[model samples]
Target: MNVRSQIKDYIAAQPEPKQKDLQELHGLILGIMPDCKLWFLDGKDESGRVVSNPNIGYGVQVIKYADGKNKDFYQIGMSANTTGISIYIMGIKDKKYLAEKFGKKIGQASVTGYCIKFRTLKNIDVGVLEDAMRYGIEQTRV
Candidate 1:
């Protein structure tokens, strides 16, 4: 259906605890960027195979490729995995910036180039995650 409906359905389809966490993250992201554009990716390729988990996205960021192509994508995204959840913060230049700045501070989460993954909300610091998300969103404006 719609983006919001798709997002809710995605979250609702998750198993226990994960479903709760996904719902919380969905609300948190909306609270941070209430006016942002919402998005939903079913994690399917051209063949429609499930290559990855479904993602709920927020905000808009234009991605410029070296081949002189550009596309609009979400500035931030959240997804539920088999083990836990993943939050993707796009538009960062430095690959190590997120890990260096927020890796340790975010608790038991894994901070990669543009992703912060954790088992649950209690395993990580929500404030630090918010800071990273805010940074990602601000970076897109520059």
Candidate 2:
């Protein structure tokens, strides 16, 4: 019904270890951004097709496009995927910064342009993840 409820439902729907990981991540994100605006995306497009996994979002960032368009989106987002979980740090201008800075330090996670993906929380360094998330939030600040 609401963003918080949708996020809880999404986490609860996960299976086993994933569920636990999602719960932990949810708590961790909130601890990092205590007063952030929460968001929930059902992974559906305008037509309601399941285009992606459900995402739990934190904070707010305004994205300005090259075509003079802009929209508000989450600064950080987490989603459960088939193989693992994805933590997205949106609004980073430099696409290669994430991989170059935290790719090796983040343990077994894959650090892409704006996403850190790993099979489980246990497989990655939580501290490094936190640092990356903090950097992302700072970079996207309005």
Candidate maximizing lDDT: 2
Q: Can you write out model 1's per-residue Cα lDDT over 1-142, one digit (the tens) per residue?
A: 9988898788888998999988888888899999999999999999999898889889998999999999999999999887899999999999999999999899999999999999999999999999999999999862
lDDT of 2 by residue, 83-137 (tens): 9999999988999999999999999988889999999999999999999999999
Q: How big is the positional error of residue 23 in model 1, measured in Å on the Cα after superposition?
A: 1.0
Worst 10-residue lDDT window for candidate 1 reads 133-142
The lDDT values for all models are: 0.92, 0.94
Supply candidate 1's per-residue lDDT for 123: 92
Tell me how many clashing residue pairs each candidate has.
0, 0
lDDT of 1: 0.92
Name the 10 consecutive residues with the lowest summed lDDT in model 2: 1-10
Question: Pairs clashing in candidate 2?
Answer: none
Best by TM-score: 2
Off by over 4 Å in 1: none
RMSD of each: 1.0, 0.8
Q: What's the TM for model 2?
A: 0.97
Root mean square deviation (Cα) for candidate 2: 0.8
